[model samples]
Target: MKIGILTSGGDCPGLNAVIRGAVLKGIKAYGHTFVGFRDGWRGVVDGEVLELPREKVRGISKQGGTILGTSRTNPFDGPNGGAHNIKMTLVSLGIDALIAIGGEGTLAAAQRLSQEGLKIVGVPKTVDNDLAATDYTFGFDTAVQIATEAIDRLRTTGESHHRCMVAEVMGRHAGWIALHAGMAAGAHAILIPEQPVSAAQIATWVQEAQRRGRAPLVVVAEGFIEQGQEAAHSGRGLDTFGRPRLGGIGEKLAPEIEARTGIETRATVLGHIQRGGVPSAFDRVLATRLGMAAVDSVAHNRWGTMVTLKGTSIESIDFDTALGSLKTVPQERWDEASLLFG
Candidate 1:
């Protein structure tokens, strides 16, 4: 059998591991031939391709970013989108199946293609861990660890300056990174999108910490918007794929906290630093397991299914189930994290 693979959306660590695992197993166990689609869906539309073999994937499991590269391209929005051309190109290339590795947007795209009669399998790859079916995505742990270390470092500087420090992590509809990293770093407060935290509340927290003669360290997700503030970003106020922009919330919230609390405040947006780096040991293991299971998913003809980590084992679920809805941070989880707030 011949298979095509592509990585889409924001680049993250452990992507190469997934590619390596899939190609290695697909070749040795199943004797399958592999082709790679470059730059996500654009490669599919234009028929840009590369051959994947064991040699091509060597030593990439520990590397950051994707060897095949990625893009935030939304194929559905264009008049000459790849979805239409993908079917034609696949037929011409004799590609029997596709393996799409990405987060929510990529899964939704794969589901759409599946409905169009394409043989596709998906692998969860969000650092946000917001995909519904998977218990945890590959890059979330690594991102959390990176953010936690950054918070730890920033806490020192905050203390020296006696200033309020706000560290922004990534999360659009979820707050897993902030919650986990905040807990790990002992942040004074952690803000997430799931919970609508007021600027007044944040200010009060900073003020209390200051009164107690301590610097306040806040961990915030980039997608977190102040309850009553307008949005600011460069994507025409759109998100990664034309949704209303939710970025710069940390930047917006910083000044509000400073004005309200009269404390010297600063913002540190970690931005892509959380996404680019060597995969942690945990992510390498998870990505490898997901990749191995993905190839097994193919042998079982689990078309339109994605490999997910549920508890201690790797399992497969239908793509529709995985993409049914975003796995947002639950209210209870936020409440538990809130105990440490202020």
Candidate 2:
């Protein structure tokens, strides 16, 4: 079989690992030929492709980002787009199937394409770790590790200056990164989107930490909103997918905390940095396993399915199952982490 692969949506740390894993396993085990689509669905619409052999993917497992690059180009957007055009392009290129490695939007697109009779399998990719079917995604571990390191470094400066520090991590619709990093870094307050916290509550936490002779460190998810002010804190704008851009929550919170508590406060938005570095050992192994499983699923004609991590093992599930709901930070998990807060 000749398989075509594409990495879509925002780039993450373990994307290259997934690509390498799939290519190596597909070539060696199934004798499958491969081609890589450039810049996500745009490549599919425009017929832009690159030859992906075993040699091409060599030494890429430790690398960050996708070798074929990525983009937010919607597959059904312009002229020559849509399922019929994509099918024609694949047929013209002699591609038998597709492996799409990306987060919700990409997988959702792949699911629609599969429904249109396209042979496509998905591998979940997100630094947010919000996909429902998977226990965890590839880039989430690396993201959490990076955010934790940032929090650790920020703690020293904050202590020296006797300031309240707010560190923001990514999570547009979820708070997994902030939750894990906050618990790991021993934050004084952890804020997430799941629970709308007020500025007064955060200021109280900071003041308590200061009273206890410790510099306050607060970890907040990018999507976190203050109670009763949801509509006022919009980020830059909407993206190609029509979702509101999320940022500046930490910046917005810092001044409020400072003014309310009468303490010097600073906000550091660890934007993009968490997703830009080398993946953690856990992410690499998990991505490789999922990639291999994706290829196996494709070979077995499991269209409309995605490869996912279920606890200690890799499993394949229908795309709809994965997309049915987002994996959010549950109240129990948040409660557990909150025990350490001031």
Candidate 3:
């Protein structure tokens, strides 16, 4: 069988590991040939491809990002889009199956395409760790580690200047990143989208921390909304998918925190830093295992399913099951972290 693979949505660490794992396992175990689609769905729509031989995947497990590249391109849009066109393209390339490595949006698209008769297997790839079907996803650990390190460094400066420090991590609809990083960094306050927090309450926490002769450290998810305040709009505008560009939450919150608490506050948006660099050992192992499992799914003809992590095991799940809802930070987990807050 000939398989095609593509990475979609936001770029992340361990993407290359998935590609390498799939190619190595598929070729050695099943003698299946592979082709990589460039720039996500746009590559399929435009028929852009690159050959994926076993030698091409060597030494990419520690590498970040995808060698085939990625984009937010929706395969159903544009002039040469739709199921028929994509199917025709695949037929022309002699590709029998597709291995899509991406987040919710990518998996949802693959689900729709599968319904339209395209054989596709999904591999969940979100740094937010928000997918409901999986206990955790690759890239989430690396992102958390990065954010925790940034907060650790920021704490020193905050203590020296006796100023409040606000660090922002990525989490669109879930608070996993902020919650984990905040707890790991011993933040005085942690804010997330799931739980809207008032500025006054945050100020109280900051003041309490100051009263204890400690510099306040607040960790916030980018999707976190302040009570009674409108969401901060990014100057960068929208992407091809029509979703508003997310950012500026930390920058917007910093001044508000300073104003309310009467303390100097600075915001550091860990923007793309969390997604770059070498994959953590945990992420590499998980991504590689999922990648190999994806090929096994393909061999078994398990189309329209995604590989997921359930505890210490790798499993396959339906796309709808995975994309049905986001795996948000539970209230209990938040409450546990809250116990440490000022």
Model 3, position 193: C-alpha lDDT score: 86
Ranking of candidates on TM-score, top first: 2, 3, 1
Give model 2's TM-score versus the native structure.
Answer: 0.98
Global lDDT scores for all candidate models: 0.86, 0.92, 0.92
TM-score of every candidate: 0.94, 0.98, 0.98
Q: C-alpha displacement of 331 in model 1, angstroms?
A: 2.1
> Which of 1 and 3 is the better model by TM-score?
3
Error of 2 at 75 (Å): 0.4
Candidate 2 regions exceeding 4 Å error are none
lDDT of 3 by residue, 1-342 (tens): 999999999998999999999999999999999999999998999999999998889999999888999998889998889999999999999999999999999999999999999999999999999988999899999999999999999999999999999998898789999999999999999999888888889999999999999999999998888888676436678877777788888898899888988899999999999999999999999999999999999999999999999989999988877788889988899889998998
Error of 2 at 104 (Å): 0.7
Worst 10 contiguous positions by lDDT, candidate 2:
226-235
> What is the lDDT ranking, best to worst?
3, 2, 1
- In candidate 3, position 19 carries an lDDT of 95
Give the winner by lDDT: 1 or 3: 3
